[model samples]
Target: MTEVDLQEPRRVPARAAGALRRAAPALLAYAGVRALGLLLLAVWSAAKGKSPHTLLTARWDSLWYTRVADFGYGWEVRLPDGTVHSNLAFFPLLPWLERLVSAVSPLSYGDAGLLVSWLASLCAAWGIFLVAELLYGRRAGVCAVVLWAVLPVGIVQSMAYSESLFTALAAWSLYAVLTGRWVSAGLLASLAGLTRPVGAAVVAALWATAAVHVVRDRKLSWRMAVGVLLAPLGAAAYVLWVGHRTGGGLFGYLDVQGQWGNGFDGGLAFARFVGDKFTSFPSALAGLGLIVGVALVIWLYVLCVRRGQPLALLVYCGIVVALALCASGYFGSKPRLLLPAFPLLLPVAVALARLRTSRSAAVLGGVAVASAVYGAFWLNGSGPP
Candidate 1:
């Protein structure tokens, strides 16, 4: 081999070590918050005579993912009330990874799913940090990662759910778009599509950003053209396959979601659901809280726009918030759905970054503890369905 070729292997480790050193702060903060959550969960579960591991790996949608991993689709449960819940409604990427991990290791499918989620959550934090660092600064980037980890619903990041995987793909895809890496963005968007139904947000962001570039330059490079073409194939392929299998034609995927009572009603169903909460005295507070929370979300988006954030971040965050709020089913899942919209926290992160480092650390540390307690309580009760 040439001298250059001989030197390349040594250079690879050097580059990886440099990257790890740079990312260490954000990664460490992410791990600390997650460890806090897990610790609280274990204590609370022990007190309640429940298994924390089961809560993380075997409950709620985790079970659905593991089932899909073990048995490749076509599984359904028909309830006594005549509703059919099909595993086909879920996207396939997470389960595919779970199966791959289990096949190569001694881990069970559930354990594999949890492991995938944990690794993906760390990747998601790194990607979030990179995006923030590109737009703001390193301090803002670290703050953003910490803020994401301390979200009230952050425990889902540690569970065997697709949120972390989908968020990781979405964040990196957005980073790729911001950096003008069209092909990389397209590939990540395609993978995000396979990971979750909301991958449409990533696809839309790619298309929107590409269109802006083309309009401004009055030219489209062949690479960008190819990327735009490749972006939607993953989601389209899976939906088409579902359509063929269910004999529902082009709308098969929608039909499958309909079976689960989920659909996009432009927030009408959500408004009604929130309104109905006011029927009783106790629920009226919840109704008021819902309205305020939604208003805050909208106001934050407005801040993003006014702050002159990139078009890709704006489009992605807007679509994610819209989808989360507009979905008709699972009234309790709105917060978890909105968890991946980390860009919405940029304004907060920026504000935090401007504070003294000691003060910021204190605030973040307190929030992390509170979030851990809440996560434990949530899982011990009626957690995400």
Candidate 2:
């Protein structure tokens, strides 16, 4: 063979190996946590005569996503109560990926979705590690990934949902922003916008950071200008398309969500939902749990602010929390919606970094096991919708 051919063959494998080596730590942690969750789910589901894989790959929102993948949009279901649930409410990127992957492989749309979510979750973990590593150190970065994996709703990361895909984009976009790679950040932010509605959080973070930089320097660089201009296009394009298709003009997308009883009421609906939980004696405990959960979320954000987390992370996380807590629909789905707000765990990661290696490992391991059990139980019962 010619010298060029020899070098090309060697370079491909070498680069692949190097990339895998670099990502091994985060990927391994992600795989371990997800495997534990799957294992527990399998055992629990087998006992209850349910299909764990179906739960992960086909139930709830996963079904909607796959439906969008198999058949293009414009699908809706009307209940006997006259409520209409439209697939347009779901962003398109996840289903797009599902269609692309299933077209090239033997996997069904559901399996393709599972595959996409699995790989995206690992990418999300690695991106999260990079962000934490940039802000703190490698130890804290590892702990941050561990903390994310052990969160109560972390199991959703393994399911066929947009959270992992959006999170991977958001984390990498924030990392790019921190490193001053504005174009890359903007591109990722755009892709995130296509992945989930909260992708606005990423776009807002990029815009806010760019604005701060301009205010400080009294001028905008060409790259920053391009990035700022590019950040919102993905979401705007999708919304405009939806509007045109539904014949509702600019408000068509909002109207679709409204039909499903979703809207931004500034948390009034959430407050009433919580209060209603207290009407019965047993539900009173559930209401108290909701109070404590909200309090904890607020406390962690306060800690992040006090610790002076980077502006990009703070902006992204704040918008995520606000959207999750303020949304009026699916009160039971708040925790799953908050799964992308991984930066909120920075405080816990920093605290874990301060401990001895053995102690941190022990704590994370225990939490991983507990989270796994909880995930199995949660999925077997009435889990996130």
Candidate 3:
């Protein structure tokens, strides 16, 4: 073959092999933790006469996604209380994947969603490890992956949710940005924007990084300018399309979210919700726990800033936290929403990396069991997950 053909064929496999070698250990550990969570969930569901598969694939947001796949959007519920719950509030990427997977295979939409989510979670874990490894080292990367896997809401990573898919896109996009691959970074960010509202964090981070590069170097590269241009297209397209459909113009999507009682309220709604919890002794304890959780999140961000994490990571993480915590919607979903904010775990990962291997493993093992139990309990509870 000619030199050009030979070079193109040889490059891809070499890069894939190198990435596999670098990420193998982290990926293996991540798989192990997820497997344990599934095992515990299965046992718990069996005891309660519930189906584990139903919990993972046919409930809450998963059900909405499958419905969108089965019957293309335009679905809405009008409650007697005068509230509108519309499937249009959900972004289209997950349902599109579910539809595509179901069309190509014998699986149902729910099955396809679960499969896509499980696979995307592996990709997400791998991307997270690569980012941590690039910043710290392989050991810290492994610790970061473990920390994420042992989160109280970690089981959501394995469920038929958009969190895993969005995270995979976000992590890989951040990695691309860190490595100065502008076009790839922008493309990934655009895909992420199509996945979830938090994708704005990725787009903002890319813009912030590119702006810093241009200002510091006193000139803008064509690649950087193109990346910036591509970053917002996914979200803009979807929002504008929704506006056209609703005939409400630019604010149609926001109107839909408002109908569902979801909006950015500067944390006033969330604070009132927490404050109400203090009226009873038992609920006061939960309120105190909420305070501690918020404080911990803030402390970790300060540590990240003091330790000099990359500007892209900080901005991405800051926006994710702000949106999750400040939103006026379901209080129970905040932890799950925060799943994509993996950089907050880095300071913890760094500390874990300093310990002996055996101790670190033991710690992770204990937390993994606790997380599995908590996830099972959380899902089994009467409230929505």
Candidates in order have lDDT scores of 0.90, 0.87, 0.89
User: Each prediction's TM-score against the native?
Assistant: 0.95, 0.94, 0.96
lDDT of 3 by residue, 105-156 (tens): 9999999999999999999999899878777778889999989999999999
lDDT of 2 by residue, 1-385 (tens): 0111100111122244664565577668778988999999999999999999899998999999999998889789999999889999999999999999999999999999999998898889988887776666767888898899999988899899888999999998887787777888899999999988899999999998888888878899898898898899999999999999999999999999999888899999999999999899999999999999999999999998888787778899999999999999889899999999998998898889889999999999999999999999999999879
Model with the higher TM-score, candidate 1 or 2:
1
TM-score of model 3 relative to the true fold? 0.96
lDDT of 1 by residue, 1-385 (tens): 0111100111122254665676789999999999999999999999999999999999999999999999889999998889899998999999999999999999999999999999999999998988787677788989999999999999999999999999999998888788777887899999999999999999999999889878878899987887798888889899999999999989999999999999999999999999999999999999999999999999999998888778888899999999999999888999999999999998899999999999999999999999999999999999988
Best to worst by lDDT, what's the order? Answer: 1, 3, 2
Clash pairs, candidate 3, are: none
Give the Cα RMSD of candidate 2: 7.2
In model 1, what lDDT does residue 232 have? 89
- Strongest candidate by lDDT: 1
**TM-score rank order:** 3, 1, 2
lDDT of 3: 0.89
